[model samples]
Target chain A: MENFHIDGSTYIPRIDFNAETGVLEIEGESYHEYTTEFFGPIFSWLEDYLEESGKEITMNFKMSYFNTSSSRRFLEILTLLEEYQNNKEGQVVVNWYYEENDVDMLESGEEYADDVELTFNLLPY
Target chain B: MGYMEHFSVKTFKQQLAMKKISLAFQGIFSQDVLALIGKSLRNTPESRVIAKRLFAIVIEMAQNIHHYSAEKQYSEKDGRDIGVGIVAIAEDDHHYIITSGNCIVKTEVPPLIERANYINGLSPEKLKEFYREQRKAPQREGKPGANLGFIDMVRKSGNPIEINIKEYDETRSFFILSVRVNKELQN
Candidate 1:
């Protein structure tokens, strides 16, 4: 499968999913008006990549800010990863990065960690 | 000329200054406009401290107007229908107040009031639990958002969401929402 990438804008995140390395990264702010439109293709790409490749994947999220709608989509992504890991397709680890003083972001990561059964790491920058 | 006869920019400026409004916008709530407002908040020194909370509240309230406001304007730039509303940010010594107002159908008043009251009554822990529960649920069909905006706003602000509904006409009512964020960071 081909790699997927999109440059981040003021209201959207940078999406870089490398099929060769099995390393997916979503970095920057995500407050786009249409969350589904922005995230739908990425979800499809992840599904295809998981089905096609037997390699382990690491998803890194470095978000400065995201609106409530985007939060739901992030949870959906985590749920998908949890399912992929559960099916024994390949190992999956999520590194959630937040700023050092951003308690809300850290707590958001903690909430997601509690919700999913995947290996989730909270890293502060 | 007729409308301009009574309009006074001086009076408007004075009113804004009196209210301590640092930023204000009254027009269509488009994504581009929101981006500009967000950038302005980030760039302002006084607001930069509370920018995260202020921005989050602005997005939720503005998006509520964008999605559900009764007043709609077709934007040639966006090539879509956008809602019209007013948003303002005021700062005092300790708090930044974010206020947004828009028109809504009169029928939406009761349910909105109920929702606001319910959210205000919840403790912080309950609010978080409610947010998570709603986040896990499937997005409602035909809705543009996940329906967790209000809860999330209150959670982030660490305060109750205040709402006012005033009768605009027989068929429509004006909806106003205000949230306050502390200038100093709080745990």
Candidate 2:
């Protein structure tokens, strides 16, 4: 299947998903005017990939900043990943990267981990 | 407090100097202006920890204005609709106070205050729990956000937010919100 890649905008994040490698990376800030519209295709692609490929997936969030609107969508993504990990034989691992000095970002990663079943490797850079 | 008709640059400068304000703006809130504000904050050689918190507060406050401010301005060049609001950042001995004020419909006041008060009443641990619940909640119609901006602001401030609402007209009122981030936490 095809991979997904979207360039970052002034108010949106960059997303790159590699189907072959089963690695999905989302980075930069996201505060788009149309939050759902921006994330809809990515969600669809991930679901399709998971159902069709049945391969192990690695989801990395290296976001510098994301607004509340984007954060809600992120929870949805996490929930889907949790489901993928539960039902499929393939494994799903999540990596959340935050700036070393940013406690809020670090805490945000921890918070997400608390809600999701999958463990998150909160790496500081 | 009653509405004041006297608002001038001189008075504004006085407030800035007296209050130790770092940044202040009163006009149309657009994406471009927000970018400039963010750039100005980044240009400062402050600790990254506090700077990130400050920047996040700015984004949430400014986005609130850009989307929900009652007063609107149409930009001819970009064909963008902008909001009118005021935002100010002040640094004191212990905390950085970020404040944003915008006009809101009178009917919106009750729910706004209710939410703010609810968030303010929550403890740190409870706040995190509340935020998780809110994050997973479905988005409200017409509001792209999950209505979690206020909660996020309260959570990041690490203190209760202060709010004031003054009736401006029969239909609109001025809503001001201030969040304080303790400098000691940066240490």
The prediction achieving the highest lDDT against the true structure is: 1
Candidate 2 global lDDT: 0.84
Whole-model lDDT per candidate: 0.88, 0.84
Each prediction's DockQ? Answer: 0.71, 0.63
Backbone clash pairs for candidate 1 read none
| Chain B only: TM-score of model 1 | 0.94
Query: DockQ for model 2?
Result: 0.63
How much of the real interface does each model capture, measured as fnat? 0.65, 0.68
lDDT by residue (tens digit), candidate 2, B5-77:
5667679789779999989988887767776777788754557666767878888898888889999899675
Error of 1 at B165 (Å): 0.9
Model 1 per-residue lDDT tens digits across residues B37-83: 88888865643435777888899888888888899999998789989
Q: Which digits, one per residue and each the tens of the lDDT, describe model 1 over residues A8-112?
A: 999999999999888999999998888999899998898888775347989999999999999999999888888878885778899999988788889999999
lDDT, residue B1, model 2: 38
- Where does model 1 exceed 4 Å of error? B1-3, B44-49
